[model samples]
Target: MTPPPTDKVVPLDELGDLVADGESVAFGGGWFANHPMAAVRQLIRAGRKDIHAITVVGSVDMDLLAAAGVLGHLSFSMVTLEAFGLAPNVRKAIETASVPFTEYTGLGLLIGLEAQGRGMPFLPYRGPFGSDLPARYPEIYATTTCPFTGEELTAVRALQPDVAIVHALRCDAEGNAQWDGTSGPDVDMAKAARRVIVTCEEIVDRSVIAQNPHMTKLPGYYVDAVVEAPFGAHPTSHIPRYSMDAWELMDYAGQAGTDEFGGYVDRIRSESEDDYRARVLTGRDVVLAALVDAAETLEGANL
Candidate 1:
């Protein structure tokens, strides 16, 4: 039998160098969902800077990067913890004018990425005219008349990110990744970005991927590197695998504006995924324990 090619499979640490120091970096997943946190930690640890971050509605991933002082510019719709209220680090940075950022509507961001993916110079869209985005993000949002209807439309400039980092539920050695749920704008970002790095919960055999071709969200051709990282989306929900660690997120949020935020980043960088999980749960995470117990029960029953 012949072995499969694994040229794209790389170490977690390699993610820092895959993208240069000064470049545009986009993150996958929605607010507090399916974020590639493990890889983000590595980049923060590497002391990377001068990054222009583009996020399609992000949370802790963006906050952590902001807290590390790596980002020089940011483009996103919003970064909040949902019911947890505003993201502390982001609020502080914006208030101090430490990191200049532009706010876009969620649809505006998606259309911009779509333009880049389709290799178009710009994409024309409706709405957002009544919003303050036109005045605030004038550089990104411009007025153009539709060729067919002769009506005024908003033209969202293409968003061609230098690198896109996303988390996948599973992938093959060749870097073919399949996500489980709520893909969000990750696929568009992967296609539009010049480089893509995928960190997955597990790397399965190529045959497993072949059996379900439709599940393959990101093909190997677009992926520059793949890192097999279990619990890679720790503290965020991966869905069908494990839920988000709300307590840990709250804890981080509570210490966001203080010096303790740096301590949290240091601890995240210093500890392994398992150690972090153990520490966050602290032998008292009933929700997680119940989920694990239920999964084990189902597995045993199936076996």
Candidate 2:
């Protein structure tokens, strides 16, 4: 995988330039898979604040941002650390009233992003009427009469994120990304956001991309910047690449339980990407080590 030109390809340190201050943001991946952790780290290191983070189910991405006190608002159905238990940072933020937030059903969040992607003002969603979400977050979830059936439906306002970022298995020199497993809301985020950033494990030749065009989840045109960041989704699984680093996640969960979350973030932010790879990711996989080397070489050239 050769490096793409400087016009579209950027080093991880330069990622902040693509996003402005106090803008809404959407992230790709679900649960603990395919998250753009490397880019997220850069965002945190850059001191980005007042961000409105949007996702159907918030996980480590949301937890990290909230812990750093960078997020001003959140739009999600729920925040879970998954099997690790509750996301302490989000819980603390809400309990302390640190950030203004909204709660919506999983379907409601998806429909909202979809509406924004399609350039619609609002999307009609059914079945959330049984819950109290409509009464609680009326600003996000509203009720409207169906023109034909006259059945009342929940209207979810469109969410146009200022910037969206995603992690991919591979991308061509032109920024066509290939994601191996479930896409979740990544496609919607790409379409809904004004700008898109793609962080990938490797850069394959354009010919490889042409062989299986069907696998290209994010077309090049939508992507504003392409970064080669192997192990970019570290601590999170990337399907065919590797599984989640439960040890690191457990460490995070442990730190998040106390006031040591800032120390945890500081330690990681201080380490070089190579040091992080040796300490966390390269214990059993030599292949991942090779990929990391390749990605570093590409990123170093830009730096």
- The best candidate by lDDT is 1
Question: lDDT of candidate 2 vs native?
Answer: 0.81
Candidate 1 to truth, TM = 0.90
Q: Compose the digit string of candidate 2's lDDT tens values, residues 1-303.
A: 966543577888888777777999898888887778887787887878898888777688889988877799988887888999999999988899989888878888888888998999999967576787778877777889899999988898998899989888888767898987756788888888999888888888878988999999888988888888888888776767777767778888988968666787786667766677777766645554344344432345554
- With candidate 1 superimposed using the best TM-score fit, by how many Å does residue 293's alpha carbon deviate from the native? 9.3
Q: Pick the candidate with the highest TM-score.
A: 1
> Each candidate's root-mean-square deviation in Å?
4.9, 8.4
What's the TM-score of every candidate structure? Answer: 0.90, 0.89
Number of backbone-clashing residue pairs for each candidate, in the order shown: 0, 0
Candidate 1 C-alpha lDDT tens digits along 1-303: 878586788887667888788899988988778888888888887778989999988899888898988888988998997878788888888899989998989999999999999999789988586897767777788999988889999999998999999999898878899986767888999999999999998988888989999999989888989898777887787776777878878887888878767788788777766676577656545675466446543345554
Question: How many clashing pairs does model 1 include?
Answer: 0
Q: Per-model C-alpha lDDT, please?
A: 0.84, 0.81
